[model samples]
Every structure is written in C-alpha cells, then in structure tokens.
Target: MPKPAPGLPTREQILDFIATSSTPAGKREIAKAFGLTAQQKIILKAMLKDMADEGLIDSAPGRAFHKMGGVPKVTVLRIVDADDGGNVWAVPENWHAETPAPRLRVRERKRGALGVGDRILARTEEAGNGWIAHPMKALARGEELILGVLRQEGSKLWLQGVEKKERREFQVSDAGEGKPGDLVLAEKAGRPPRITARVTEVLGDPFAPRSFSLIAIHKLGIPTVFSPETIEGAEKIAKTPLGEGFGENGREDLRHVPIVAIDPADARDHDDAVWATSDDDPKNDGGWKAIVAIADVSFYVRPGSDLDREARRRGNSVYFPDRVVPMLPEILSADVCSLKQGADRAALVCHMQIGKSGELKSWRFTRAVVRIAANIAYEDAQAAIDGQIDHPLTDTALKPLWACWRALYKAREKRSPLDLDLPERRVVLDEKGRIMSVAPRERLDAHKLIEDYMIAANVAAAKALEAKKAPVMYRVHEEPSREKLVALKDYLKTFGVEFALGQVVRPATFNHILDKVGEVDFRQQVMEQVLRTQTQAYYAPANHGHFGLALGSYAHFTSPIRRYADLIVHRALVSAYKLGPGGLTEGEAAGMERIGEGISALERRAMEAERDTIDRYVAAFLAERVGQVVETRITGVTNFGFFATVEGIGGDGLMPVRDIGGEYFRFDEAARKLVGEHSGTEYASGQRLPLRLAEANPVSGALRFEMVDGKGAAPERDVKPARVIKRRGRPANIRHQGRKR
Candidate 1:
C-alpha cells in the first residue's frame, strides 16, 4: 500500500472531530485543526466530499460539516413527543437524512414545559447512548404553512391564501410540480417587503369537492391520521367487557333508567344522555331528581397511554361542514364510548337532587352501566312536545326532561346569563361535498333544555371536586377588562345608549342593554359590541367565575369523547369519589396548569380552522351569484373599507373606500363609521344597504362588493395621501385636529 498523506485524518477521526466541535467545522477548520500541508489541503477537500457521498458527514449552511446521524452542537429543534415520565423529545428542525431523525431528550433549564410542535434553540451533547439537548431559548412559533391555489399572473406565480381575512398574495419562489390553479401546500421561504413561498405538496384541483376542509386540515396542522399504536390501543380497549358481572364490579347498574340522548339530526356521536323524574320524597315536592351520564372516555383513555397522549395532543374534536377530525379513534369516539340507544355503555354518571326552586340541593358521582332508551333529534324532540308527532318515548322520557328543564329555566332567568341571540350559520353539503345551502340554524327550546342540564351537571362536578379538595380544571370566563369596557362604552354612546362604567358588570348587565334595543339590526350591532367586550373562556387550574354562564364555579364534565378538558374532569371526579380505576394520577395533577394552557391554545387553533373552512364554503356557495345585487348589513368599518354580511346568508364582503365612488371618506373611530366628504353620505354598522358582488375568490374565501348605485370613479378634488390607521384610540381625522375649517 502507498504511504498515507501526513495530515489526512481517518474516517472515524473526521466523524469525531465534526461531532465534538465547539463551533461549526467546515473544510478549512478541519484542515487547520489537522495542520495539513498546502498540497494535503486539496486532498482533504476531496476526502470530505467522498465522506459526504458515503453518508458519513453532511454539509449545513456556511459549508459547515456535521455527523450525518447527529445534530449540530448548537441548532434549532422541533419538539415531537413527550414520554410517560414527563420528559420532552425533539428532532432537528430541518432534518433531511435518509434515516429517521434521532430523538433527543430535551433537558429544560428554568423554562416552561415544552409541548409537541414547539420550536427551540438548543445545545446538544452525545450522552452514554442517546443524545441530550439543553434548551438555550425558546423560539417564536413559526407561522403555519399555507394551503392555497397557485395562480399565474403574467408568468409570475402567486399563492393565494385560503382564509377570508388573508388578503396578501404570496409570491411563489419554487412551484415544484404544482401547476397554475392547482391546490398546493406551501411554506414561507422569505420574509416581507417581498414575501415568498415554496410549494411543498401539489394537492390536485382547488375546486374539487371536499377541498375546503382539506385546506383547513393542512393549514392548521390538525392531525387527521391516528398513529398505529393509538389505533391498536383503542381497538383493544373497545373489546373490553362492559357487562360481564352486570355492574357488580365497581359500577352501578342504571341500564333500566330510560335515559335519552337529544342531539342534532346528523350528529356523529352521542356522548351524553339525560334522565329525569319527579322527586318522590314528600319534603322535596315539585323538585326533581336527574342523572347526567357522560361517556367514560377516561376509562378507555388512561393517563400515560397512547390513546391518552393522542387525545391530549388533539385537545378537542374539530367539526367541519363535511366531516369531523375526532380527538379519539373511531372505535372509541364513535362506537365504544358513544351513548348509543339499546346498547349497554359504561359511563360516569352525575346524580343530582334539585329543590322546588331549581337550586341544586345535593350531588354525587359514580361509575355506572347505562343503556340509552332513545337517541332523538332535537327537531323531533321539539315536535313531540308540541303534539306534532306521536312518539312512545316522548310522554315517558321527553316530558319529564321538559318539566325538569322548566325549573332550571326559572333559575337561569334569575341568574340572567349573557343572552346574545347571535345566529350561527350552518353549511349544508351534499354527498359529493358540494354546497347545498347556507342558512342560520333554528334555535329551539329543546336545545336550551339539553344545554341547561349539561351546565347544571358541569357546575355540580366543579363543586364536588372542590368539596373533596381535589384538582379541578375550571372553565373560566373572567369579567371584561377596563379597556374593552371603555371601548364598548364609547361605541354605545354613538347609538345614544348610556352605559355606566362605574357599575359592577355582570352577564345580566349586557342582557339588559340588549333588551332595550327594539330594532333587530341595532340589537345585533349591540350584541356584537357586547361580545367584543367579553373575555375568552378557557380552562384553568385556578378558580375564576364563569361570567357568561353566571356561575360561581364551572367545569366541563360532559362530551369526554370530544373534549380533553372533560376527560380530565372525569378523571378528577373518579379520583375524588373513589369510583374505580382510571383516576387522575399524581403527575397529571401536578401538571394541570401546563395542560390547561396547552389545551386552551389548541382550542383556539381548532376554532380558527373551523371558521376558515366555513368562510371558504360560504364563498364557494356564493361564487355563482357574482354581479348580482344582494341585501347586506354593515358589520364593521375601517379607514380603508367597510365590511358587510349578506342578509339571509352570512359571508363578509368588503367595500373598499376607492370603490365607494366619487368621494374621500373620513373614518370615525369612536362611532365606527365612514362619512363621505363630497356626497355627505354616511356608512355605519347596522345600516342596511344594497351591494353588488363584484368578485368572489373561492381559493381565498374573499368577496369584493361595490355600492349598487355608485359608479367606480375617483374623488372630484385631490386630497391628502392616505395612511394606515391604528384600530384603537382617537381618530387622526377628528374634527378641529390638523384641519382648517
């Protein structure tokens, strides 16, 4: 064999040097460290290239070298999983190795617990067998990837956002295999002034049926596919015997109680059943006894298990117009855990005693075996009560439920919860996923009856946990902040409505303000303002009164099949009552705060995804009606434009100031209006107007409108250049400010 070059390092030596380097080691650094001669340097470069080809070392930015299977000493990582012992695991942020990315145990240092999808900057070291990462700092979360259609504008490709409020078109840098008008998922490649994106996946046609929900599923990072382990766990748990000993083993038998579930007509799963009857005790005349049985999801999804982890990661089931992204596998969420009629199901039942005045006198929790007598749709239940349909279970089950709900309604009236009668739009889709129609869902008394019972049961669970001094995840909705209240007051003054800021605020206060508005349009406008004034409700370990429900304590204990918060509550109840196994564990109890925060964030994400999908669906439904005049109500106003929603169908469309025609409009911030200088015409929220739909983009869920009578013409006189305005505080164009009258 020929003699080796004097400074050439062996393969093992090169790998060790790259792995242990304090700083990024490129070819020059490696050559310097080995003291290579000038001629040896050329040989070293060839050796490094051969090593890279052999998959021994990889090159990063700045031509830095790293061990192919190892992470850089200092690098960015994305958290992927958490173990049973509460340890988090992460992988390289930009992994491109042929092998699966190595999981590195993250050792947090005086920082909050990290969750899946969180990004961090870490310093890594090779431990005895595995890699360990010490987090240097947490990175701001990257924006979710965009799911949109690729469009070609004069040979320049642009990616259109699939959200109603996303107005900017991202410049496409690399289109990959995506063609113009194809649905594609793209990631941000460059930052602003000239924002750009690179298409990652070409998802066929953008106008295909069912594409609307797919856009949301990918854009929001919602998990639609379950892991194999979780599915196997669910299947195994689903086969567990529910009636071996006939409720003799740590379970009460309530199969003969004639419980009934009332839900929507197209409900996919029934998670709650209600049973009520008159209180037979003479001392509690006119009172009622009730049981609210919720699906025993905690029993099937135990802590530290695969099912539990996946459920926690989902936070809650996301319901779209066409389908549902369930938190649990179908075996559990749809079949085993659902309260199906005539099938014996294990449940966590809440037994409550009510007084004549509908006050909850006493409550207890127990594990039980239940058999739902019927699963009736809300419309059918209301119909039976009105004598429109003759049903066998109605007189026996539905009547008693209504009787019980009447008493609860009395209590609800006294508490006077915030009753904003906002109409929720429902998107009905055909089997092919094409839009059939969009309309406001009917509000019925039967719906209110079921809601009240659930609320009562949720309150009982919270108070029961408090009595046992156990952990509780309260559904907290705090009073509005002073800033929001002040804004609401300023807006209300525009309507000549007096709102006293000094008075202590309650749900009833808003309800009273809404009651005084006789006009429906004005009432809706005020309702919107009231909603903007309220704080978002969320789950927390600490107690904060539920302002919307007018309850001193509240917790979700129903629908465990859909919501993780309710599952946690179920575990708490089981541990508090000593009902059986599947109780809250010590580790879970200790991390309640972190769990609350993570799930709350997931809930917000789900809401946004659902809303975006609905907007897309609405836009698609109205695409055929372009150039037609429609009745609209102004919903919001800004300096640049005013937003309005269709009268019968709800889809927001913007009327830009430039399209309003022949005038320069001044934005009135406090009053939330726009006044045209030349025409002396005024536009404000709650004003009914006729607008011609000019353009509708289904890919972006955006709609553009113009005044039905006004021509699209420039203002008669030249005016000062327009500038961006902040959403808060006083308006820059207020009278007598920087103006000559």
Candidate 2:
C-alpha cells in the first residue's frame, strides 16, 4: 500500500489504510501519519463521522475508529430461499445495516441438504464476483423442547414432529415405554433425514378427553408449575393482609366512594373497579367524573425481589380454557391484590372529568386505598340497566355507572374508531371437563361500557406520563401495508364493491367497506377478511398511534394483577409524579427500550399458546362428533387444499385437494381462489357449504372435513351478492361470550 503521506487522503486511501492496519487507528494518529494540516484534519474528521454513520466504521469506543462488521470469512446464516433448480441462498445471521443483506449461494452438494427456515454455520469465500458458501455445521432450531408423537412402524419406533412447518422424524432407540398414539418428549440429535432421538417422557394418550390442552402446554414450553423459592416468597407475602402497607403519606382514602367491579360471571380475580358521580361544581354542569381504580400489585411485588423476577420472566398471565398460569401467585392475584367487595385494597386510580358534550376536560392519577361497594357480572348489570330485573342496587349504585357510560359512549361515537363486530364462541364444559356445547357469545352494552371505561383510563395514563416527559412503553398499531390493501381490493372487487386503491386511506375507509357488508349475505366472511388486512397491535417505546382505536396515544393501565405492562406503566407514573415506593428505577428507565421489546415478544408467545390450546380443545370436542353434518364456510383456498371453519363450533379443518375432486386445481394467488382444470369448478372464500367431520386428531390439533353429497365440486356462475335480512329483535338464544381476561 502507498504510504499515507498526503494533506487529505481520499476515501479509497482511508479504506485501504484501515484494511491493511494491524493496529486500531485513531483520528490523531491518522492525521499525524498522513501529514495533514489543521483544516485537513477537520475534513478528515467529518469524513470519518460520515463513514461511521453509514456503518462503515465503529464510533462507539470514542476515537478508536475500527471497521464495522461485514460478510465474515466464517459466519452463521439462515437459509431464506431455495429454487426449483436446487440453488439455495442465505443471508448473514448477524449482518449490519444492509437492507436485503448480501446473499451467498451454497455449494451444489449442500444445496438441498437444508430446508427453509433452517440455520447454518458456513465457511464463505468471494468467488465469481459473488460469494460461495460451504456448510460447516447446521444450527439447531431455537426451541429447547421437542414435541412429537411416538409412532410404531413395524417394530421400529419414530417420533413424528408436531409443528406444522417441520417435517423431519426422529428415530428413537429408548422409547421410555411409550405406546403408539401417545404424545412424547424426545431429545433430538444430528440433523435432517438421519436425525436420532431418545424419548425422555411419555405424555398421556392423545385420544383421551382434555389431554389436548396438557399436550399443548408442554409442547409450547409454557411454565405451569412454580418453583419452591417462588412459592415461598409468595406465601411470605400472602401472610400479610391487604392493609399492612397502606399509610396516609402518599395514599388517598377512597373508602367513602361507592365503587363497584363489573366482571364475567365466573371471574375469580377482580383487578379493577369503577365509580362515577355527577360533577357537583357549576364549571362542569351536566357532566360526570369517572374514577377507575386498578389493583396496586407493585406495592407488594417490589423490584429486584423474587416475586418481581418471576413476574417479569412470565411477562403476563396465560389462561387456558381449563386453567390459568398466573404471572403472580394466587395469593396476590386472587386475594390481597384482588378488588373484592367490602375489602380494603391498595390501588392506582385514574380520575377523569368529562364535559356535557362528552369530551374529556381533565384527568389525574393517584395512589389510593379503596373499598368496593358491590360485584356485578356483565349480564346482570345489563339486565339491571335495562330495567328487565328489579334489582335493589340498580337505583342506588348502578345508575351512576350507566350515566357515565352514556357520556363515554357519546365520546366514542365522536371518535369513530375502526369497529369490526366479530362475535366469539365460548365452549362450555361439564364436571368431567368434557365439552357440553359451543355457542357464540352475546355482545351486551354492559360489556362495551366496561371496555370504554378501561380504554379511557388507559389513554389517560399514557397522556399523563407523556405530559411529564417520562419514558413509557406505548401500545401502538400501525397502518396496514400497501400490499395487503392491494390484495384486499382484489377480493373486494369480486363482490362488485370497489376499494379506492393506491391512496392514503384512513380507518374510516375500512369502516365504509365493512358498512357495505350488511348489503351482502356473507357478513361474517367479509368481516374476517377485513380484519386479516389490518395490522396487529403491539407494545413499543416509540408512539405509533393506534390505528384500530383511532387514538393518538394509548397504553395498558388496567389489571396490574394480570398484566406486567400495566404494572410498568403504573411504576412510570409513580416515579414521574413522586409517588412513594415501587417507582420506576433509573436502571429500568435506561433499559425501557429493551424491556418493551422483551414484553412484546412475551405477549405474542402468550397469544400463540392460547390460540393453540383452544384449537386443541375444539378438535377434541369435535372428535366425538365425527360423521355428523355441520355447516362450514370456505376461509382460505389453495391448490393443495382448502381450509374451512365450522359454524357454531369455530373449529377449522382442511379438505385436501384430492378430496375436493379427482382433478387438477389451478391456484390464482392474487384472487385467492382455486379453479378445477377438468370441470372448471371453482372454490373461493366466503362460500358456505355442508360438510362431515372426517377426522379430528388431538395430538396434532388437526381437524379434517369431507364435503357431503358431492357438493365439493361446484360449477362457476355469475350470481348477484344477496343482501342480508336484518333481524327484528334480540333472539332468545343468548350465548356467553368468552373474552380474554
């Protein structure tokens, strides 16, 4: 290399110097070695800063300028794509700021060795002006626990993986005395077609009732049992009653307020309560002041303690249909911290004043001590409000809550949020845990009232923390992607409903499309498709403005006993406003970004686990009803198969392509339809048909259905979308809507 003895070195010269240097280079040393003047040093400084900003060099370690990461000679990568011609491409696992990270082609021998979503550590070299990689080792899948079924094939044992995306089977030498059809846990060794495993445990037989949830719980690695240390810590705290930590220093006595908690009929742990009264001051005539009090979990679960550590690890509580894996021990979530009637409990309170026009005028937060006046279920409260039942407490206690709900409802109407009405199913169980029946849950005004109250409180908490300029984890939802809109528009075109594409659209645009759904017969199908096009909401440190609720800022602030995110928000408010003990610490503030990401990941994991558990339960319920005719709707279609969701039961099943008919099907990806080649028969979404339950496998949570009366193959025809007939009155068949508490 040419010796750097110039006034100002070029970019190429700088790169070459650093590449050849054995020692780390600093600006002062670089300037001295290059013989640069004072003005030239400034130019070099600017160039280095620009380079560092572009990720060409590291600037974190003060003046020691080091080359940033690039494609390493030996690095780990994930196989992202494989072509029909047997060419496999991968990108670096730990790459820097490069968008669409540089791809490397694998050697021909290793091209088809790994499947999609597999990771590999490889040795790479620059070749043919591109890059070539040779796999040195295959990285193991991240999941520590392997869930599968023990299969006996002619006296040889194998473990069939449970995951839908994974296909490889493991050979088991030691079966742990597990029989065929039993769910098993195996320790996998080696890779690909030659992988081996040893059965460590034999879960129950898959066909047994209620065994589905147990299998899913272990398969997903959800922690169900608490450790002895954690239990001891909980018991020690539980020994103290609710009033042991309360004092007048920073706590407000709200015992005089007649607050009541509204929850589900079978709810065991109540974490929130509401009380509202007419604003007495003339400045707020015809208005109301609503107070929402949440259980003060932080007061007992302090930072760096055993309880706090375990709660943080679990992130939040997970509830299956049959049981719950609580974030805190039952002693806290169900007893001390639960907002039970007539019980004095610690609370974090949000007080909001609304105007006659239903707009919020002001709001504040406080640490409080409260006594709940009564406990009411949603159904009973609605009945009381409607005057259908002559309840003694209706005029005395429930009237004020209904009044406040009226004003809040007005404000919600003015807000015009994205409202997609999709009723959920609740499965009832008998004493022995067998599914008795499944029905759609009723959406009562009382439920909406409590939801409005919680939403207002959550928003106020976010606003209060933001006004104080404190670090906060916001509940955010972004606008849907353009690609999703394009596909949604195509689907909408099938119904002769036009979607204004390639423009800046608002939530109201979706509301408009949904409004037109009543003009068609497939209301449920259209709503499901519309919901799939929207973005999922999540937690983050930066504010992204929730699209679904149409709120500029929002956060989870209720139910601290169940959700850790709410607890974190409470701590941030306490620290920001100088509330006593259990405030957010400096260490937590500095790591809030990482904390948000960790808790968001935990939230997704909990959602997936719950969904899987429910799927298993539904499949087990349907296993007994095989060969019975059921109403089904086509939810998705592809060349390989079509997925249908059963009516009333809400269980989804697959009807394979061969079973649809003995004909080749052409898949139209954009239109999301499958067309038969021989008969020109079409299978599309939003189509309702009758089917018989062919099989229900609880082990894999798989439900299979076969079309009845040869109705699987239907000829395509141009038919007008029919308008739905509006119902006259509320039907007597009211179902209890199972909600995620």
Candidate 3:
C-alpha cells in the first residue's frame, strides 16, 4: 500500500522519508528529503564513491545517479558540524591473531611501539574502536580482531590484559559518554561493518601480580567459577576420604615398607614417596619391584565438595619466589592431605616389578592403605648416599636406600638415554624483594630415586588406563618445530661447530651435544639455550608421548596437594580400580573434562609466575654487582646485542651492540649472529665474553652489561635499525672448555 506522496504532495512538502518503499524515488526526491542543495548533492555523491572503495557502499555508475543499500544504510542529515571525519578504529577489517585464544597480534605503525622479544604492551579500545573477538566473523568461521600489539619476532602474542573495572569514563563523542567498565558493542559510524565490544571487568593495577595473572586468565578464558566460598565448602566436604581413605577395607597394608620422601629441602607439601625392594619372588621374572605411594588426596578431597570446586577452578597452585599460592589450604596441603614425615596417611600405590635389565616386567595399580615411614629432605638423603651425614639418616636405613639408588643408576644405562641434564637456577631474594644472588640448584642421587619410582608409576598408570580403556588425562609432550631447529643451527654456527641444519633436530642429538660439553665451564649456558629451543607439553586424553622423557606414556600422579593434575590422576585411578580404568561418555564426565582444561591453563600460569619471580630475583642480584666485571657465556644473540648470563647467576642480562668496541654490529636473525658491518668481527651464541655490569634497575629488574676488552668493534647501530642478511652458521669453538686430561 503506497501512501500517495508524489502524486499528492510536492517534493518541497515531503516531511520525512521511508527507506526501501514499494514506490521508487529518484535522486532529486531523495535529496529533497535531506533538504539538500544542488552543491550538497554533489558532495554526497563524492562521499558515496569514497565509501564504496572500502566495501561500505554499492556505488552507482556515474555521479549523476543515486544508489542505496550498498553501505550499512545509516541516515543522518548534515545539521551538525560535519567534516572529513571517519571512525576511530585503526585496524583494518581483515586483521587477525594467527594463533590460539591467548595470542593477540597487531600491525605496528611506529618505532618503539614493539620489537621482537619485548613484552606486549596492553592498551584499551578507544570508545568504539576496541579489539575483541568478532563473534559474527567467528560464526562466519573466518577472522577475528583482538586487542594486541605486534612485535618483530615469532608468531606468538605477548598477552597484556586490560581490566574493565579499572577503566575510566570516556567521551566517545561530544554528545555521548561511556563508563570505563561498561561493556560496549561498538560499530563503525564511518566505514564498513566495524563492531567491537568492551568488557567491564577491571583487571587490576598494572604493576600488581594479580594484573599479570588477570591478563592471562581472561585472555585464555580459563574458567574461574569456583570462588573462596567454594574453597571453604570443599574443606567441609573433605572430612571423609574419597578413595583409599575407606581405611583398611579393600586394600593391602604396606605401611611397614621403607618408604622415604625425597623432595626439595624446604618443600612442605610432599606428594609421592619411593621404595625398591625384592618383589614377591614367586611372581617376579627377576630383580626387584618399585613401589610408589602417592598421597591418597583423592580419597580425602571428594568430588563435588567445596574444596574440589575451588581446586577445580584454580586448577593448580602457583609458586612465587618467596611463597606458593597453594591449590588447597595449609590445613589440607601441608598437613592432612600432605605426605608428611612418618605420618600414617592413606595412599594410592602402584606396584611394578623391575627385570634384571631394569625394564618393567609387570605392574599393578591399587588404592593401598599405607603411610610414609620417613619425611627426609633431599640434602639429608644425599648425605646418606655419600656417607657424609651421620645423624638424620642412620646406617640401618642407609643400606636399603643406597641399594635402591644404585639399582636405579644401573637402569639409566639399561634404558634409553632419557636423562637430559638441564641447568636449573635457584633465585635468591632479599627482604625488600630485591635479588640477592642466583645459585645453581643441586641435583642429587636421592632426587633421582624419587624420580625413577615416579616415572615407573607413571608408566604403570598409563598402561593400566590403556588396559582398562579408561578416559584419563596424559601429560604428552610434542616434537619441536623444524623452523626453530634451522634458526638454532644458524645461531650455533657463530661458535664454529658443525651440526645438522636440515630436516628436524633430534632431542637425543642435542642431548649428546650437551653431554660432550659436560666438562666445559660453559656447559650450563649451552643447556640454557637448549631449554629455550624446546616446547612445553601438556595434558590430553590421547597419547602423543612425552618427547623429553622419551616415554610412550606419562602422567603426573604426584603432588595432589599442589597440582590439580595430580588430583585428577588420582580420581581417575581410584574410579578405574573400583570400576576399571576405561573410557566413559564425555556427557557423564563433563565436569571433570572441564576441570582438565582449566587446570591445564592454570598449570601454565603457575609455571610462568614461578619463572617471573625468579627473573625478578635474578635482576635484583645483578643490580647489587653493577660496575663489577664478570665472565659470561653468550646464551643468546639478537640484533640488539648478545644475551650473557654468568655462571652461579640465575638472571639474564643484555650486552648492547654499542658496548662492543670495534666493528658496527647488526642482528642477523636468519644466521643467529651479530656480525660487524665494517670489520667482519663476529660473536655467536655460546661464546665466552668478559662483560662489565653497567646499569641495573630495580623497578624493571633488568641488568645491562658491556664488553670490557674485545676489539673488532663497529660503530653502534641506530636505536631502531633495519634487518640484515645472515651468513651460514656453525657449532661454536669452546675457548674455555675444561681439558679432558
């Protein structure tokens, strides 16, 4: 039904216009609706043409014709002071994060905006210009725009989080106001279909640890549904045991075994203990059986309890430098559920027989009612092995312990060469959170005793789960990237050693290289490099095998008090033994499956936080020794300078190219070298250099070092310089490796 407009009403008399009507209107009639002058009509046509190029509008053939419906069809009369104004968003419609949920990326347009290896700088979405996931585009299964800053490095996002509640109010337009924390669904008023949303949850103060954690949690969308109340509630429901906590009912008593705890000296929340004794002679093919009794935490922390809910939420405990943010309360983690010394706590035991060759013969998993006979520290255990400490570890206990460790020692040679000696540093902190020192953490035989038994238990559990067809989470590590190996190979060549740069680099080959340098003073630095070239692995139901351990199956079945993974493993094992370890419908185990994802994310968070804390301490320690000359190994090389870390120091410091006295240096990413543009003087990864600590800052906890005596220096590169081509790389020549004699 057409309202008699043109036939009855003159163009000048028309009050308002209706879009897409049954009756067609000419340009003049539509222009009349806007009360547009002849000159203004020409301007509108020009504006339409410009908008069309951006996919915002469908343009007519010539300036003489008027078209509609190509753009979003927003109508506004030119009553306000309108000029050549556009929308506020800077990102193009096609920009996207090329990685997973936590990865955020952006195109940089200015210097110092970001560079490779720099921390991602977090920013807000100015009014309607924020970057978040575009759900519609996601529904369309294409691209998404995230709020992130791009860096000059690998395909990874430096996740910097912004909290909504902390946002201040903004005047998006002179006529409009929006609060900082308010969630806004913004669309482009200027260009093609542009829309973004802002959430109202303020992340917290930027410098706060909570802020860092917030960026990670919200960015990854790790479920934090369980609250403090839930934690309190879990405590209430955990009074009764979940599995073997059913007491001496359906399990064997192994409390009399010479079970001993071997953990970090300061560790309070113990998890698993070890014992290797002669197996039931009638059943064993040969040799002894290793018994691993992990704390029966699943027995006490029942499913659906408040504690369980909160534990499920945190997924795991985060360890900081000075303290640990536990998954459970101190009452639970440090006492009741903890595998405390000499305490008669219930446990879930895995019994496996070891053959003459140290290979597993047969294994059985059960909820055993037992207690830890010894709560000894690793140092004490180490002393006992060395026959040094005469007090804590008695001669009577030493014999059995020594025998077990000796047996495991032989097993290493018998088994595949899986023991990869990685350098680990212990960060020291002062009273004011400043770095005191960085000391190498000692790895001992006692530590291995515990490790060997745990590894055996992991194998047993994996096999049991597979045998029963149980749906359980396995900690699987994946293979390294081929591209990373090429980069590493190029970097290694600066030091002058021949290595495989083709195909993929094997862990065993890398391990062999590290072993060859074991007598070298710079071995730790090389080991540190190896750590960077590796990838972190995590939990999945399907078996991918652990790359580092060279194991076909692996799982974390210890430290339930601290790690949620351990608890999940315990729960699975308990259910399996009772009902048989097997796959169940995902529908029936939705809660637990969700728990797996959340905990896996938290585990990463905890690891990152721990590393961050150590970095802080290392920085603090370096600050104290500023202006002091220290010998350092070039653990890494970049366009900026060589990254050198001294032995006995845990923190990393930078040596700017300017500090090198002789030649102009440039970063060659392809070659992983710092080459002199003029002199051709070079330095590569793993080279020993004498660096004088120049400057250190406490707030950022970063240290800077300068070369003391090396010649062949080139003029310093500009603050922000262009990239350069790299030469072929080789293994480094050891200038300071200890002689075999």
10 residues in a row with least lDDT, candidate 3: 72-81
Clashes of each: 0, 0, 36
Q: Tens digit of lDDT per residue, candidate 1, span 477-572?
A: 988866678888899999988999899999999988887776666779899889988878888898978999999999999989999999999999
lDDT of each: 0.85, 0.77, 0.55
Give the TM-score comparing model 1 with the true structure, all chains together. 0.79
The candidate that wins on lDDT is 1
lDDT tens digits, residues 1-741, model 3?
A: 234333333322321232332223344555654566667677655444343332333322212221222211221111111123321212222111122212222333442232222222222111232232111111121112122211112432122112222222221221122233222222112222222222223333333332333333344444444467765764664464444234336556787777777788778688887777655586565577677888777766666667766776777876655666677776677777777766667677888778765677788877665777677888887786677877444554545655655666576555444345765778655665444557877887777777776777887888787787776678877665554565556545644545675534445767766666666755655566666666667676657678777777888876678777777777777777672222233442555445555566567766765665565456555666787788777777776567777656755777766557544665656456676767777777667767887766432345677666644233343334323444568322212122234
Evaluated against the true structure, the overall lDDT of model 1 is 0.85
Reference-based lDDT, residue 550, model 1: 93
Off by over 4 Å in 2: 1-143, 165-168, 239-250, 710-741
Off by over 4 Å in 3: 1-228, 241-251, 280-285, 391-398, 417-419, 429-436, 488-496, 499-506, 515-526, 579-597, 666-671, 678-680, 707-741
- Candidate 2 local lDDT, 1-741, one digit each (tens): 355575688777786666555445678767876888899998998798667645576531224555564355566877766766777788876543324467898774643577555778887765656778889888985444578888889979888887655667777877887888778887655444345777878886766666666766787677777788888888897665544544556488899998899998878789899988888898667699999999988788877888988898888888777677889998888888899999888898999997776677889988888999888999999999898887767876689888888888898888788888887767677878777876788899989989999999989999999999998879888777665787789888877778987667677788888887665556677788889888777777778788888899999999788788888898999889876778898887887766776677677778878878777777777888888888898888754568998887777888866567655565655466767667877778877888888887666667888878664433354323212222345211111123334
Q: Report the lDDT of model 2 for residue 698.
A: 60
Model 1 residue 123 lDDT?
89
